[model samples]
Target chain A: MRKSTAPIISIADVKNVLGKQVVHEHLNLDIMKGEITAIVGGSGCGKTTLLRNILMLLRPKSGSIKIFDIDILHCDIKTSQKIRHSWGVLFQHGALFSALTVLENVQFPLRTFTTLPPKVQKEIALLKITMSGLPLEAAFKYPSELSGGMLKRAALARAIVMDPELLFLDEPTSGLDPQSAGAFDELLLDLKEGLGLTVVMVTHDLSSLAHVSDKVVFLGEKKVLAALPLQELLKQKHPLIQAYFSGSRGESYVKSA
Target chain B: MNNQQPAQLSFDKNTHTLHCSGSWTVSAISDFLKQPPLTTNKTNRIQIEGGGISRMDTTGAWALHQQANALKKSGKTISFSGFSEEHTALFQMVEAALPEKQPRPKSSRKPSFLYVLGKKSVDRYFSLLNGLAFLGEVIVFFGRIIMRPARLQYKSFLNVIDETGYRAIAIVGLLSFLIGIVLAYQSGQQLKTYGANIYIISLIGIAMLQEFGPLITAIIVAGRTSSAFTAQIGTMQLNEEIDALRTMGVSPVIRLVIPKILGLIISLPLLIILADICGVLGGMLVADKMLNISYYSFLLNFPNMIQLQTLLNGLIKGPFFACIIAGVGCYQGFQVVSSADSVGRKTTKSVVQSIFLIIVADALFSIILPWQSV
Candidate 1:
């Protein structure tokens, strides 16, 4: 892939440890603007850990993480909070505030970060809810009342309610059916073009990586093994990369791609 | 300066048209809506020109929808021009998905006196019935163990004893000792006025042996053991661990509740015995120091003061209060709903209910056992 003039996110020399066990060491990566990047790895390979580190929820033992050129690891609380407004995160479980209705969940960040009138805030929240393909009536229902698909959509609505420049999705399609996952992928692409968002997603779905990801970062053996476009990465002669792409799940999608 | 103009809504009196321009995202809309530029009620035929609008999102769509609704409400006909296909689609999508207005039921400020009384009485009646049913199930669980001693979970019973009974000894011993000291100190002062100071020994011995020692130990266990049991089982229920046990054909009542019940039954009396010793020792020490009563004199009267019946009275109440605490805690655990908050609420309810029922049971035992005649 051609290099962009500047990357939206930059990580270098990152080290992560949980007690005595090292999860990641000397990991380096850059994510460009308006591109969807997927981080894929074997089970327990710390994909989620890296995502948490970049989101500033977890601090690595040693590393520098820059988001939109701001040093995230060393920032003051006020600066970090201000920078957080430009990004959105969709957790694996939806993680909607259980006590709030769907509309209230979507409106939470808007209420916290903006001084907009309540009427306008509600209207905007409703609009985001619709854009995420949820019915208007769902706005009144609590998170527990929603089905799995509706919960993901409601979570998506909340993530994008602020029109964030960067969006992080953790296993967005893991539990979804094929049809819904396809629709979700199409929605991501549409949002990318329409709103010009930069997306970083942790996904195990090979078909999603083949179809939606501009670049795939493969983590293994306590470090990043490779970062390349799906096609090029599949073509690599590395033994681990070869074994991964030759697997039954990857074989089916690789043939189709 | 001109290029940085956020967004504006201006009307031309000649053409009856409203033109909006600049960024119309959330931040810009907030500024523009502070003092809205046009009133749609003033015109019947209005044209909205969006040619100058630069950046728009769902928030902008919502803004336009709000404007359209305001215009339509006042019987004004409006038209949009120069909006892109994407913009039009986004605006129309939000417009179509607006929540339908529903008439809310009016809530009265004060409920009628009869309503409050009826609701509360019904709630209390059902809760009482529920409690009796839970107690019956616990008794049935013990009956099963009696019939098939091999079915008893000996390992888990020991585990619960280690957690709730053994771990709780320190606090129980400390609190009962302090109670003994306070009782002797306060009563000794008043007894001296009547030249009855030596009676402080008898008073301390009888009270600690028959009431305060066991009562204090049970109360501490109620707060410690019962709350932990409730929180543990409630969290298991939340995570479907209890459901998993059921799916494997293991009855939760037999596997979970029985062990806890048996543990508390055995541990409560044993812990009470220990607490009684600590309480008697505390009173003797206080007497030796405070009232100039020597330890030898205190010990000489101690055995006479503490009759075998008095110790038996306190010990008999042990397993009963243990049953109440363990039973209430586990019952409240099963009562937990599917939420993190429900676990907390049920734990608190378990502790309060256990302590309350323990005191009530103690009162009933005292009344029925003929404490005064003895």
Candidate 2:
């Protein structure tokens, strides 16, 4: 990652959640323009909470978040919408339209964000569907008919339908089989190179972090513990990192890595 | 390696045994009901083999009773021969609690078709009367529209026109033509006996303008446009698209419901007009060909039978039917639960309820219109 490429996303001294309970506090992070970052942690470590905060889905009680050098908190509604359009999100469970065919699901963002004609819209949807490694035959089938893997691919197709600059994937490989998950990692790598996308993925899938992530952020101890390359993460003396990397849970991942 | 397959169950020339296994619960009762019936040969007797039965509950006893009932239905002897002591005790307890089946008395009188129709009419009379409740909802919806005109968006009006009006042209036209032909054939047959076959034009023209034109068009719109709106909105709700719209600072009612209501309101009258023309043309074609009536005389009589009040009545029904369609469609869509099956159920209900409301509204109009004029 080039240091000269000023951070596209910067979270500064953020404290989030309300009431007497604080979910996360005193968090500071900077994500570079064109790099893939993986947020990895155990369950209830508030990794998802942090991503939601950055996405402005949740407001911080203190401090600020800047995306593409624009303060997300202070931006007007139109500017916020514009900023959101620039980023694509792949929710857990793929969140594809159960009623719509895969092709229409992929066409959703394109239809919402652009004034492209129906034929052009269809062509763009088909291209993204193809890029996701799903066949043309699967395009007209509903999400219910798709297997878990195909649903993820279709969702990925939708996420990139508008050729978004930043892509956010929450637990992309969580429910996929080992082989399908490996294939998904390869697809993400291909997309990262092909589309020049800056990806921020939240995952418990250690195998994904080892194979695809340029940098991994381990959220622990009420803050981000370390954001480093896989090699560096492996060598770290952090007890939580060591515990996560040295067990039956980490064995398959170590082998894949 | 041994490649032989395991032995399958056999239904020989004697009693057949069905082995029941697994933990039986209320949730699994449906699956248990779907089990294939046991077959037997010369002596059609079904014997339960309960050796492998691991767990039994109230649902299991009910399933056993259902199985026995099926065997009895098939004219076979059924017995629970191999039940464990525990299973036997459970069955006895259940049998004691079961209600006695009442014998249905055979009716001596074979009711006529008209009698059956009259009975159904009586039974459905309350349902027909209860449909008046929808008018209160309609009044409330219109009251909201009038009170908060700003809530109704121009885009929604265009959307409603597109969905209800533009999408329904071909279907309404086709059905209207078919109805016209049927009306011509029936009226021609009647009028021929009196040597007045030319009167088919007046019959079809009056019917189309006053009743069939509005009613048939409304029914078709209910089935097509209302169901589409429900399914579209229901699916959006399921996919959290509606929630997303709310989060993004857009009111779902304004974005979704407004367009559908506007479209249906604008389209229904136009569609009725088109149906009216098509129905008349269909009648004219049949009158000239099948009835050997002169087209010019038929056309001359057609206008004399159709008054401006009749045309206005048909046009007036459009907005009312549109409101009914939109209200029912929006109500059903909002009622959609978070599942694909619920979406389908809501879509079906939207169409059924919309058509039912349309008919009820027509009845009310028929009763009140003469009173209003007086």
Candidate 3:
């Protein structure tokens, strides 16, 4: 696949201090349009924090961050809402509304943001639900009725129901079995290619990193250690980057690279 | 600043094509869908010219599909022209997944009166069955706890007592006290007119002890403690903590429900006693202010007119009311199957059921006990 050089998200010299601790300092990163970027880190290494910063969910102490060429830090509420409408977020636990069935959950944003007639909305929602690899019967079931993999699929359906240009997934494959996780990665790739979506995912799953990530950003020591393609990032001389893939489990990815 | 032009379709006469134009994204399609975009009335073979379309999304694709289907229904053969690769892929994906015609969502129309009555009766019958099953379990576990006291969850039992008993004192006392004051004021007016102002003691005392004291305490606790019990237990069930207890060879009833049952059984009577005292004190204050009756005179008259049996008659219902509240609350908690939605719904049902049962029990108490004090 040919990679686009156009920057979809750019963070310049960002500083994030949460309470008494410095989570990230001088963190500069760029995510290109149409690339699947993975933010990988150790536990408490602030993968979610960086994702939150770029998502405009957290205010860094200092920096300029841009998404779709618009300055996210200084934008007003209306502009922020427009930015929000253009992107989709899938939380770690598949945060579907408990009361609504999967179909209703997928249709929620469409109903809220669009003036589409309900009939067309249902058609679009059903389309997304099918594209997410869920059975049509799953649409009528509530979130609590779904198993782990089904929950993820339902959440992914809701996320992309708007046909968002950008998709954010947190630990998308964390709870699924390996086969299901691999299938999820394949689904992610299919979505990114078919929908022309730019993906930014926070995941520890090396399989996901190897399978789908077009670019990898390794976070450590309160900043981005390196941001490169998967094969290229594996060659980094930095001890932290090396240690990230030096574990008995991680070595398999490094060796495969 | 999304200043994109809304999508539009223009008809061309010579080629028999509908020229699709402008931004066809979801944000812009709102105004386009208001008026039907098809004007292929004359043409037998209509072509959609897509080169003029600047932007499109899944919503746009779906809209086009719908418009195309409409044209096809009128016996017009439709084809796409100048379509980009992305648009074609989206169109194909939407078409592949789209059901020919989706069934409309189930209507929320009201059912017939007989249907509602039958459904409600069946629902109530099941609730009664569940209540009986839950009551049987509680009795069995209560016997076990009495046989071996060490098996009881003493820490949780103390916690429940502290929560249901000590924490609830203020609201229960204040509400019943207000009721007492209102009672004294209402009856004092009639007593003063009859030149028997001091009879306000018997009027307020008998009413407070025989009816309002225990009844008010049960309702307040049902609102407060019963709802809390239901919510706490329902959330535990939702989180599978109750399941965790069961897996560990611990009975959820002995550990969770019994503590609440014992605590409320012990605390509610204590609360009723506190409410009774506060109720009388409020009545005494109102009598002093409104009827020229001193606190000393009110206290002296209390022993003469208000018999011990009147006090016992109201106080006796406390444990029974507590059983109703705790039983209904815990039963509803057990009924939560899966969702946080069920927890919320069950919590509401618990409070309603507990209060309703408490009222029924109060009515039975009045019927069984004679009106005259022994």
Candidate 4:
């Protein structure tokens, strides 16, 4: 692979917890600037941990993580918070604030990070809420009042409220219906191109990987066993890789595509 | 992990032999103390054989000495047949601090259920009762608010008014009207027996304004609004919103609990006053129609029957009961574990516990207040 323009996120020989005993040893990976990358893995594989490490939510026992060339571990709290604000994370559950209305949830990051007037904040919040394809009527309704797909859109609205440069979404479409999941994929693709975001997503949904991912990294057997495009990944000879693509797991991908 | 298993021990009371083996630590001593006494008979002699003891520390020796002393005090003889040199040294150290055992009084009576359950559980129940003892806590919580005059969060205050005060009006109004009708019906029968049916106004006016009106209204609010507060916060906790607030630098107590507490504190008295007025009006309509009493005569005696103390007493319990309801609600909410069922369980517990405490507090207040002098 042509060494992509100076990598935005670089993990050097990272070691992390595997389970009760085993650890992921000496894993090195780099994500380039302004591109969408997908980390795919089977159960017990450490893809989520790697994303967590990159997000600085988890500290590696013995390795360095640099985001935009700044060493995150050694940075002070204020500097770390500044780095965190530049990234948006969509947790697997959507993690929308249940007590807050959809508009309030979307406005949370803005209210915390900016000193903009309330009117401007509301305008910005409504814009993002609308951009996520939710109805204007949803602005006043709480998360408990929303359906599963609407909840995801509300979460996406909150995630983009800060206009984060890096977007990390963990299983964004896992629980949604097929139509909604495909719509969400298109929305991600649109954001990736329009906003020039460096997106790192961990997903079991292969259909999404094929549809939008610029690069795919397969984590298994305690390392990044393969890093290739979704199309090429299907042809790989690794038994685990072949099993994943040939089984019920890959059926959703083929059917959706 | 290899050393984590506990060594076994058994005592044959019929044979008067105590068998033991273990590396006994303080934790092991505590575990031993948790068991029932070895012998039931006060005069039974006991023998402890420590030959199988692999490792004995000071704590183990201390435990042994205590057991021996307890046995001796119960009018029984205790003999230690085998002891390692280390164990002997520890025994000597423990023996030096302990007082000489004396003959214990024999009891012919059997132990009660409470005794069998042990002091620890008794203490736990007492503590739970103490937590449910809301009169003092209610007084203190309200006293602080009224005396200190802390700068209230106007926005949250208004939010609570919207949630507790306005939302509760319909229910309180409906219930009060029904209670009035019941009161009138019950009193009308008794009053008609004496040909003094006009006195129903005095009965309803005095009773509703003095005691039942405020107490019933406060209890209803505690059941309806306070439990809702707990369930809402408990659900938020289960959903991680409380954690999110903490991570974002918002104090959940001040932002959430204080508002609800203050809102109830402000609204409950007003609700009681409203219930009292509505209840009196309902009573008047029933007495005038059902009892054939003139509305003019009922009104004439109503004012004379109800002193200023009646209204004052009702108003007094409002803030106190409000504090009780709010505090219990928030306490239960904060205690919720990360489960959906915990929300419902805690909400129900908050209402039940709050009402129970409110009544008990009222009883205590009635006994202590100078009502006779007034």
Best by the lDDT measure = 3
- Residue-level lDDT of model 3, residues A1-257, one tens digit each, is 42678899999999988999999899999999889999998899999998888788899999899998899999899889999988999999898999999999999999999888887678788888887778887888899989988999899989998878899999999988898788788777766665678999999999889989999999999899999998999889999988889999999877776
Give the better candidate number (2 or 4) by TM-score. 4
Q: Residue-wise lDDT of candidate 1 within A1-257, one digit each (tens)?
A: 22365899999989999999999999998989888999998889999999999999999999899988889999898778867877889999899987788999999999998789887788778777877878887888888789888899899999999988789999998888898788789878777766667899999998889889999998888778888999999888877778877898878889999
Interface RMSD after interface superposition, each candidate: 4.2, 27.2, 2.4, 31.9
Question: What is the DockQ score, from 0 to 1, of model 4?
Answer: 0.01
For model 3 the local lDDT of residue B122 reads: 100
lDDT of 1: 0.85
lDDT of 3 at A254: 75
- How do all the candidates rank in terms of DockQ, highest first? 3, 1, 2, 4
Q: Candidate 4 regions off by >4 Å?
A: A1-4, A249-257, B1-374
Q: Which stretches of candidate 3 lie over 4 Å from their true place?
A: A1-6, A12-26, A52-65, A69-74, A175-183, A238-240, A246-249, A253-257, B15-17, B37-47, B68-79, B100-125, B369-374
Model 3 residue B175 distance off true place after TM-score fit, in angstroms:
1.4
Give the TM-score (vs. native) of candidate 4. Answer: 0.46
Winning model by DockQ: 3
Please say which candidate is ahead in lDDT: 1 or 3: 3
TM-score of each: 0.88, 0.44, 0.89, 0.46
Residue pairs clashing in model 3 are none
